[model samples]
Target: MARGISLNRRTFLISTSGAAAGVAATGLAGTGAHAQDGALPEYAAWKDPDALIVHTDRTLETRREAIGAPPITPARELFVRNNLPTPPLSATDDPDVWEIAFEGVASPATMTLGELKRYGVTSTPAVLQCSGNGRAFFDHEASGTQWSVGAAGNVVWTGVPLARVVEAMGGAAAEARFLTGTGGEDLPPGIDPLTILVERSVPIEALDDALLAYEMNGEPLPIAHGGPVRLVVPGYFGVNNVKYVRRIALTPAESEAKIQRTSYRIRPVGVEGDPSQPSMWTMTVKSWITAPLHEPSSGAVVIQGVAMGGASALSSVEVSTDGGETWQAAELTGPDMGRFAWRPFALVTTLEPGRYTVASRATNADGDEQPRDFDPNERGYGHNGWDAHAVELTVS
Candidate 1:
């Protein structure tokens, strides 16, 4: 279980009031931490007005109304998840000057953003999704932010291949079993540092597809989105793609970083501190409806959604207007972004004035299909089960 913070309602109200006053006096928005310019990044306020702020003002989840955005999520509208408060690194406008330390190899080295760019750049379209994207839908509430279905985005990442960087650093040692990444975000005051660091690790095998991305969707990565450089692990959950990445180390064993070994692990109900339970890695097959933002008027309506096959390619997505009793194939729309990006699907139908239940399910090329229900787990690390994503809507 996570530790809790205690604060009297009076004290909290007073503190917030004072903060708002400070912001007003400074002519700055009260939405996010101030950057070096003494202002918040433009992207910081790009979210929908109804977006859920799961953690104070640090993490923002997009609302369902904005889920079916463009093929590539707009930089300003992309979801934001910060393990810690976003540092004031926005003061540094020149991404070329940012540096990353590489250690634990035959030749420990460091690479600046400028130097990293010399390796040549490559672009790949992929999806970045929170490991707990659908945690809010769980029958039992889970720790952390209770997110519904909008904690994901599809973007084209432009960067240098991590494998090349590893090779440039003299390659990995024979004993190296994991590649750990550490971010530059700072923890809140009064919090213990040793027990909580925004660090995570992936198996050495993932290096082949990992990247040190500097651009997203053709734009320079914004400060709110880990500008300059961030790790992009294709096919892995968003947590594995550390933002504000500062260091990369080759280790003989998986990182013992709290987030790597404990927080992201999947433990069964009533299980606590069990090392036997494995940590989350690749996401599971999942799909969700995005259209019919609300109750629709009777007539012709279009239902659209997105599906991801996780490590595999998506084979098909089906939609059912009569609950899960029967389903019809949804037309797979949009150009194929890539094997790692979400695929869009749509279904059009006529409806009468009445209430209806709609659901969506996706199947992967590997023959894996979304389940109708999933067993409850602690922390809600991975909610992707056989359960179909269903919504109740009224037509008038």
Candidate 2:
């Protein structure tokens, strides 16, 4: 069994508060005395309240909620994603020394981290979630990390608008549709034979709302969480949020990098193909119920979860108390941040003590509704569908 799975009650309370603060700090830096310190340090262990919510990416997906309201995952509870542990660089390593280079573009250019920040930067709260977020839910064994539920999270990310950065590297033409980003991570042997060197890219249109963020939760980013800089695609999976970014190239072609080529793509729906099959690039409409703690609770229970689409607007969210046998509408909240963010929806309901299953289904205006159960994939690349959580309630 994977040991990185557990959240206790105490931790939950703490994380909840921190997440709330993060929501408040969205688009702004922290005003706390330690505002200059940076976001909370990664937990010694990746555990949360109830020992039920375990985050392999150090709670990177903790920023998301189930149904009620969208709470900013505070720096404290914000998820941490590190392909590798924190790489330390001394303060003396001149901020001016941090430079970014662009290749495979019409006009490649290099700029220091400081210079990039001075460019057209803006802040927005986006949900940076992992493509394999719900991998554990798959019936078939997957190849990569078997994340149970907490592999994804949402946060108030602050950074320069991606489009502005591209414009700085020589204006983009209408034909330039893809932007490939090469980061500093190198693949270790025996991982994936076809693994593209830790590089990833997205369609240029996706950059309209994408961000080249250097700050997370309103402070200089921690290296463990893609410090220096990273890409934040508004509605895409976390895999697309390439960390330790060193390059951003605008191209008129599609991306076939290792990460984009071998991973993150989804196979045909309703069919279980080879895990290693090449497939579609778009993400499916998805939602999840997060409240009632998935545990049976008596009296009024608040239900909450998030819904997202690839490049579409979320239309509606529905909930089912008795599994999917019956459904009721849930109140949708939050503004459509972009392709990389999920909208929060919530409803309050009363429950009787007993075992129960709750689910949330989201639909995008494009008429794409989440499936009750998505076809299990061999690679567990995409697991977006209706989220069904089972909880037991006891009453005296």
**Counted clashes in each candidate structure:** 6, 31
Off by over 4 Å in 2: 1-70, 84-86, 89-96, 173-175, 186-196, 252-257, 267-282, 294-297, 333-340, 387-396
Model 2 C-alpha lDDT versus the unseen true structure:
0.59
Best-fitting candidate, measured by TM-score?
1
Question: What local distance difference test score does each model get?
Answer: 0.72, 0.59
Backbone clash pairs for candidate 1 read 370-386, 371-386, 371-387, 372-386, 372-387, 373-387
lDDT score, candidate 2, position 84: 50
| Tens digits of per-residue lDDT for model 2, 1-396 | 111111122222322445434323322233342222333334323323222223232333352332235545444444455555344544214544666786655567888788878777677766656667666556554655444345555677888887776776667755777877767665567776345465666767777877888887787765656776777776666666777777777776645565556555566444554336654344668776556553544788777776766557678888877666788898877776654467778878887777555677778878988876667665776776453222222322
Per-model TM-score versus the true fold: 0.85, 0.74
Clashes of 1: 6
Report the C-alpha displacement of residue 52, candidate 1, in angstroms: 5.9
Question: Looking at candidate 1, what is the lDDT of residue 119?
Answer: 78
RMSD of 1: 7.7
